[model samples]
Target chain A: MKTQPLVIAGRTFASRLFTGTGKFSSSALMEEALLASGSELVTVALKRVNVADADDDILRHLGHPQFSLLPNTSGVRTAKEAVFAAQLAREALETNWLKLEIHPDPKYLLPDPVETLRAAEELVKLGFVVLPYVHADPVLCKRLEEAGVAAVMPLGAPIGSNKGLLTREFLEIIIGQSRVPVVVDAGLGAPRTPPPPSKWAPTRCW
Target chain B: MSFRPIFESHPWDDVKASIYAKTGADVERALAAPRRTLDDFRALISPAAAPYLEQMAQLSQQRTRQRFGHTVQLYVPLYLSNECQNICTYCGFSLDNKIARRTLSSVEMLAEAAVLKGWGYEHVLLVTGEANQTVGVDYLEKALRTLRPHFAHLSMEVQPLDQEDYERLIPEGLNTVLVYQETYHQDDYKKHHPKGKKSNFHYRLDTPDRLGRAGIHKMGLGVLIGLEDWRTDCFYAALHLDYLERTYWQTKYSLSFPRLRPAEGMLQPKVEMSDRELVQLICAYRLLSDEVELSLSTRENPTFRDHVVQLGITSLSAGSKTNPGGYAVAPESLEQFEISDERSPAAIAAMLRRQGLEPVWKDWDATLTALAR
Candidate 1:
């Protein structure tokens, strides 16, 4: 059976497995794991890579044709900084695709809904395909959809906690009502831990 | 009002006494604690923690890698001027020193920028002495405007300016400002800087507050290590950083520890810190906050730089010429201080690679600030 490709902002992604470039001990290991996973859409933190350097290590390994870069504004705290960083990432990485994240608290890395909504509106106006990292709030998801985000990344749990779909109830609500693609970012511990496809099929685990 | 109230609350002598009184048990407790605090930091920097250097280094390496990855950021300093109006006891740029002062013209500044660009450097730190008449706000604005287009990141380490001055310069592509409180000891601070605008310790103490209010993207904080008791000074700096991080929740912060080195007729360090002690301080900082940026400069010898790269440092400066026009125009002029590691950018990059870490030269970009206008 042939599975349908995932489409985001007119770009078709063959693989729905989205990966992030962080936490690996070395670039070689990260590259190996990412290739083995066969993920087509990868996210890189703008703060982590030297965008101006042609030979940035993380970027050097991610130059495969099958992979598309989704630069994230991870360290920014306000909408103004997010907009500025999004434009910079677009200019340097040559991708209008952005993962808008504005988390003021450092302990849990929880996304700020107000700032996320504000930045999403501004970024969409600036011609960016913003996919905001936000909590599993159905109302905020609808609001982001109204603001023209290419997708909405709602948390399964607090980022990196590895608890596995602690927000399943909220996730079901968001997935049922979301007008755009839903990517469940963070907190899936193992490959077998994701809920069955009877819940929602297209919302990939990241 | 400012950091003044917090500064006034902590008596220097008492803080020193408490740090000295920390025991081996306190060190163990601090090491084992899940969430470290200001008191835990004291125990980590105390003499009792000296025996656990290897353990601290391992923990520090783990925390650093977990947060920053296996990478180090490289930046270079561009001396825009050697002019000064301050009389400081430790510096070679004091008003009493007899030397030829030079301020780069807009043309001369760009000439030097071209050299750094050739080296493939996108981050540049613009340095100047405390001469308001020559290298004041207007001069800094012009320098930023001239070099903004050529570099991805521009940081300033000149004399402290007002809140409004920082507000004006941020839109001109100034991303960071580094103001080191030479010493936190008020008496020694007065003695070291007795004859100029820098003599106003309170104004200098409040500079970071002003920068935070101006909404700078980042700021660097530290005390010149040899000025007072290193442990006490560092604890206060950590405390100050704690205050700033909570107060200026929106701004990012970095910390640099610059040991006083020899310069043209410079004063000797009152208390010399061993290389081992410096390593302990670096590890202690990482253990305290996994997020704060730790930077090492060229003042230390090459061997020291090589050894400490794995021990929690995230930023480094290489191929640094501390004198204005030293790179292209005037190589014979006097420098602010003698740089020890004197390696080229490529050589340093090679060194980082040899140690299994990637060297990053352009982690920032100009478009990050372009929209501020």
Candidate 2:
């Protein structure tokens, strides 16, 4: 069985498991893990990079010719902050692709549905390929798709709990109903299962 | 005028046991159900579901792939100030710690913004202590104005402000506010926050209500894991989020699991939430609301964060600075808490790519916050 590529914002990804850079022990370890996983698109929290003098440590290690940087507004909890973070990422990472996240709550760090919807509409209008991090509410997913989001990212669980699919039903509904791509972000666990559906298997934000 | 339901309160231990007593059959039933209800959530979070982690992950991944299609959202935190009045025992900025405190000046805030901008970050989370005079509403407003031009989105993590203050700041480009209840246990809450206005648990509990009333677009919620029973505290947090969502129907909500990371002058965490338990809790929250943003900060170790990328996490914070001007202004100052994963942005991005996830930036705009106003 041949696998298809997962494409977002004009990029193609061969693997289905998308990972984050935040929870690793060291950069070298994270780099090795990413290489081991064989992902094409990687997410780098803009706050961690000193995008200024090309000498920033994080950016330097990501110098692999094959990978593209996806700077995210992970810490910004509102629409305004997301926009500002996106602009910074664009200037530093030199990419127009952005992952919109606005969660006003600090403890749980959940996204603001209203702000995300509002931001999606605005970011798409701003010429950036907007991918929004949102809850598994199917209605909101549709709204985001309508607002022109490149994709909708719903959490499988909290950011690092490794608790798989707490919102399975709604995610199923979203997967069935969504017009854009469905990437399951956050709350993933060990790859203990027989690998995911190959290629166009659909709905995963690793 | 005391109107209340008389349903007997179940022992928290009982509820937790119930949460764990689920069977594989129950898990299958929960998984097979066409439309999930709260009962299904219970089964999914139960121990019986442990054997089905792969199945659950596959479903979660499948759903996520359909909606998000292989992408990951990235972000960073800018510590605005470390001058805390609240005595959070676990924090370096706890009032009683007597550490050297620092709050960013307008200039310092700008310098930090410049650094983040150069870092290719379009989002920013502004952080500070509960000190009002140095990092109060007025100071926040000024800092927002200074930063508005540099970044696309801005959020704050500081003292809880009045609805009017949030209203004012929203217009100035302040977008989100992260307020974590140190713990839900009212008594323990007092013990942890012995001094300062933060001790007023009721007031803090009612903060999201105030934020909702103020008509802010999004708000974040969570509990500090070490101070109380993670289960009960999390249940209450979920209850709070549920209530707030109904009340603030138009607003968006997210949750975080802040396991106690040892700080400069705090006691050891009382209740240790094991990795398995953390996974259960995250799954519980995910089962509760797929829409709610689940965030993992640099506080967590990298291996865990890496493992979870495909499970169920929506947003992540990397290379975070938890001190005032920690980015460029004053690198040596005190931090509210030490960040665990200190990798640079590029290194993190490379890791994400290897996982087959695309990093996203510039997802929102200041214009949207103004629209809410």
Candidate 3:
């Protein structure tokens, strides 16, 4: 039997492999890999793409029927700046679905729980679908849920470290406790290293 | 928090020992990794990576082409003054050095600017010694206002000023600031800068933080290569760059490799960095961060400058004059440091074209800064 489809913010996603639009050598290669993976939801960093240009390479590649864009605020340091960037992205990309990522620390790129919670609450109140990338802190997940975020994305390891499932126990806690969809983001380097199959499996992994 | 804390926390000797301890295997691992870290940078710059020079150069060229395209930005330095209050041991403009001191008048500054414009130069770097009395904030403000209408982009390499002073100059078309730490080794720093405000290492160390706080568009960083162990000083510069990029995400960064050149009454270079080692360092910087602009100045010979252009260097300063009014007004003034590559800007541009790369003269505009304001 086929697995049930994942739904987030009233939208249905058929594929479990949510991909990121970074680290690829070229946009064409990224599009080829993303299309082959059959991912319906993809995340792109707002800072990485030139939103002012209508024919921006990243945006042009993601202009497919199956793909839904998730613009992320990756470079912003504070909640105030994140909110401003989210509004700009919404206007530029014509999408209200945002992946809230506030990593003031650029080296490890660990998410700031305080800024993420603040931005998520503000974004939700602004009538936008908020999906925050955060640490695998169960308490932060509950707080984000209380903030009315559409989804909570927690790291399995440091972003891009390829150290799979370092936070398995914490992921379990977040998955069990999260009321909204829980998307496992960052550090799941390989496709085979997903958490053990359980009733509380994550809605998506990227 | 600022980079000062991170910089102060790391002991110099420990970092040096760790860098010298890197092996060929570590360099190979760093080269093969999909992503690189500061540790990888250390490994890349280590002596172990010397054998892999060809490979590093190839990777650096590829990364540079990918990010900056086949284009080299062109700039010229207009030395505003040779006057100084600081007694820098290696500098020709030291206060104790017996030399003619001169600061260009408004008319003389325009005369120099006019010559640069005639040579099709749009970017100019204003340089002066650490003489706050003669060429302080007020003098700098006047110079910027006078030259703002003449150039597309303006940068300064003067004494480090307060954050408020930097904020004051940005609106006057101050696009970039080049502040070299000279050397990051504290003991060596004190030895080189024994007198005046330049002797205050902490204040100079925190200049980049002030520039960042002032909301500058760009800043260039480096350490004078001959003062101490080149490898360790570069490692500290890379660390500072890492911290700045994170703390000031909006600001762009560039790196320069200024080896000590012979000048009047100059101290002998403590450590001589050979051409091959300098090439390796440049390539390593490119492989570390593909986006950081690498600039080559006229202090390098024509042959070496031509060779390194393709490796990773994104900017080049050609036909440089190191003294005030060296262009046309008064060419007899004592030069800052004798320029090695005396090729004119047009010749350099032709050389870049011969290599199938474009020479960009005006990559920025004042309107963008105006819009930002």
Candidate 4:
């Protein structure tokens, strides 16, 4: 049986997999792995690509017709910086879809829920499809939904930790409560245990 | 808000003892750690880490190359004045030195700038002895106005000024300020700077805070290497750097290691920092922070400066004149300190190219700051 397509911000994704472009040894290898994953949505960090350069290595590899770019404000630490970087990325990458990430603490890469909520509200008002990466806190998820974010991406663990579903209980709560599509964005180590097919399936996993 | 509290808390003796107490195990731990801390910096600069010089040098070279690439920013110092009210014990420009004091007139300053421009220097450091009367904010403002159109970047190594003065000069195209705490040891500091405004250790210590608050683009920091225990003094410098970096996140910081050089009738260096030890200190700084610009001045010998470009140095001064009008206007004047490397700027640029590094003359522009405004 065919599964239902995940719809977010008036766009439908045929594949449930969302891929991230980081930590690959080579851009070619990253492109190969992403193609193999068959992800229709890919997240690219604004810090990683020289957005002004059309021939940037990462941008050069991500020209596939099926993929839609989600530019992320990854290195920004405050609502002000997030807004500035989002505007720059929107202009450079030519995309209104943004991954609003504001992590003041660099060591843990934990999202600042307050700054995230503030930036998300502003960005949504500015007509952006804002997808905010946040902790698997159900309350924060509901707050982001109220802020009019396009989607809520809750982490399974600290970013790049390779520890799957460390916040499983909170993820379940966020999935149950969130009105927008809930995407599991970080720290899924392996594909062994996908959340069992159910009414509260994650919109996409990266 | 100021670095004074943090500076006072890290007392010299306590910091010295902690650094000297670092064992070989601590050095190894620091070397192996992926992300180093200030404690790791203490370990790296400790005498116990001398045997690991090669390892530290390799890491420093790699880190420097990764961050700054194969280029060395070239700058020349334009000595605007030798006038001073401070009686620094080790300086020829001291008030009690009884030498003819000279402050370059606007015409003389323009003449000096013409010579530096001829040498293809785009970054010029304006140096002056502490004389608020002769080389005060007004003099500096006019000098910057005269020279700003001739160069892309302007730095000053003059007397410490108030925050408002710095704020005023910054808009006049002053991009950088170098304020070295001659020594961090408070009592020893008093011994060096006996009288005059320099004797106020607290004010001198808090100058970086003032500069940061004034929104200066960059600030260079160091302690004159031969004053006290070099390791402890550097630790305090590093501490100050860490504080300022966190406090004023927008300002870029650079590090200079100026060992005491012989001047006419100047006091001898109490504690000598050998070339190997200086190398160790330079590498330690690179390992500590990958982004802080490491600068080598003309005080170092030609051979040493030639070799150090590959290590961790990001900026170098070529054909420097430490006396007012020493470049062309008044070559007979007594220099603040005798320059060891007298190589011309062209010679240094060629040497950098021979080592497969490009010599960058202009890396910043006033238009960029104007555009930001």
The weakest ten consecutive residues by lDDT in model 1 chain B span: B364-373
Q: lDDT tens digits, residues B6-26, model 3?
A: 998888999999899999999
lDDT of residue A158 for candidate 1: 72
- What TM-score against the true fold does each predicted structure earn? 0.90, 0.65, 0.68, 0.69
* iRMSD (1 decimal) for each model: 3.9, 10.4, 8.4, 9.4
Top-scoring candidate (DockQ): 1
Q: Point out the worst 10-residue segment of candidate 4 chain A by lDDT.
A: A197-206
Q: What are the DockQ scores of the candidates, in order? A: 0.34, 0.05, 0.04, 0.05
- Give the DockQ (C-alpha) for candidate 3: 0.04
Model 2, runs deviating above 4 Å: A1-206, B1-26, B46-48
| TM-score of chain A, model number 2 | 0.91
Off by over 4 Å in 1: A1-14, A22-33, A45-61, A74-96, A103-110, A122-128, A136-138, A155-181, A186-206
Model 3 lDDT per residue over A128-168, tens place:
99999999999999999998999889998887657788998
N/CA/C clash count, model 2: 108
Instruction: Sort by DockQ, best first.
Output: 1, 4, 2, 3
Candidate 3 off by > 4 Å:
A1-206
